[model samples]
Target: MTYVKDQSFKQDSLEISIAEPKDYFALLKPRVMYLVVLTALAGIMTAPGHVHGLIGFVSLLAIAVGAGASGALNMWYDADIDAIMTRTRTRPVPSGRITGDQALAFGLILSFASVFTLGLVANWLAASLLAFTIFFYAVIYTMWLKRWTPQNIVIGGAAGAFPPIVGCAAASGSITWDSVILFTIIFLWTPPHFWALAILKSQDYEEAGVPMMPNAKGLDRTRLEILIYSLLLAPVGVLPWLFGFASPVYGVLSIVSGLGFVALAWRVFQRRTGKPADSAAKGLFAYSILYLFLLFGVLVIETAGALILNRLG
Candidate 1:
């Protein structure tokens, strides 16, 4: 629950343990990595094609590693600011468990390994996408946008949006409208999800000197932005079905989940003026993770089911 911590005030029992390799892995943010893998797998599955099992496995591994590389690189770059933010202060780099040099080396090695493996096992197109995702996340998002703009997550969100496209290219050696829609769903969902966390964590951001939306715009305006994004997300979530890639099952599920997102957004909007703002924002932030995961989970299952049904029929 509390992660690894061994502390005592008696004698010199000073815990000399550095954040283990596992801590570095945690820096990768496994929960986010899982989403990356899942959506990528869904894209590979939903696409009309055949891929060798070993190659598919390698491709996914490469994407996951690239994602972890991005996380480590981000931790390296944001170490100073991370030390000031409650949410990020415990990261390996900031906690003195891992040094920035170690992180940079780890990220660089993983990035090259991932792209090379993906290229050999899958396609050059897939490999290129993975490379760009890493660069975008490491350089663009972490180094450039994070400290400079209120729209940091809005634009930096593109880093997280690339996996499905990477997976599509991995399988079919190209991109498609369906993959773009998959990218769009996550893209639209990112700002609201992150902004909610930012709202509750505004002081942390401000203290860290990161220009988060809430630190840039007032609380009321951020809440309004959350609501607006929620409204846009509803239509985007159901677009797969509308465009004929998914079934009515996904359509219904998307609508229901989107409505839940809206309800939480409404609560956040109403609670923006009080000390309750933090609670409201935290609730929305937690639910937003669930909402996105479930939406994608259902999409994968329903899409797979449709394929099986069509085969049987």
Candidate 2:
């Protein structure tokens, strides 16, 4: 009877110790990771030289892991506020599926492993950039700027913009104007994209005490700021073509998409009350995602097509 009781206790303990794999995956913030991978691929493809298949694969994997590590750390650190916000209450750390300690450990371990692997397979410059990116997002953005200032997303946007630069460095062992252009485009795109969502979720941010633009500066101010960023982003989005890396097709697509972004922002700026306002913000937020994906997708497609043509020639 004693032996059976002990065996049952051990089994229960073992089961309790195991967490669901999907919960762990959620800590990685896979949606954010997907964007990181896409921008990083564009960086690699647009760089000046060819990368070996194995090296390119390894570098991208390392960057993805590093981005995941940053996400995990962000979730761990923000778990307290996350629980207070409706938008984030269901995340792994806040939902009771993952403990803070577990997330911190997971993030730290992955951060070290990714930087080391990237340095081994690519150049240290790329690895160092990845390390800085993780640190910036986890420490600077999450621990400091996010709660302290309304301009958090503006400054913290650099972390998201670094992936392309890292990818470019990994492929060419150096940063170039092309990579900087990619970085600039994403950096400019972040504020308008996030501010649009902030308009819709300002109440959640206020309750959580996060100083998002809409909460800190009022909805009117946030709307104006979004419009301004969209205007700036329009011309910057066309830079790759002007720099000679992208074709006229990309230029035309960028101009048209940029105009659409500005138009959406203008609607958000004009609609200031009730369902109209919410719908406009929602529309801008959704279109911002599509706009970014379209621009980067075109760049990747053009690069791939050129490479194929050269191979056949």
Q: Give the top-scoring candidate (TM-score).
A: 2
Taken over the whole model, the C-alpha lDDT of each candidate is 0.87, 0.95
Task: Compose the digit string of candidate 1's lDDT tens values, residues 1-313.
Answer: 7875675475556645465879878878788899999888877766667777678878998899999889888988889999998988888888888878888888888889999999999999999999999999999999999989899899999999999899989989989889999999899899999999888788999999898999898788899999999999988989888998887888898889889899999999998567788888988899988987887788778876776797799
Candidate 2's residue-wise lDDT over 16-101, tens digit each?
43568999898999999999999999999999889997899899999999999999999999999999998899998888888899
Top lDDT hit = 2
The worst-scoring run of ten residues by lDDT in candidate 1 lies at 8-17
**lDDT of model number 2:** 0.95
List runs of model 1 lying over 4 Å from the truth. 1-19, 306-313
Tell me the TM-score of each prediction against the true structure: 0.91, 0.95
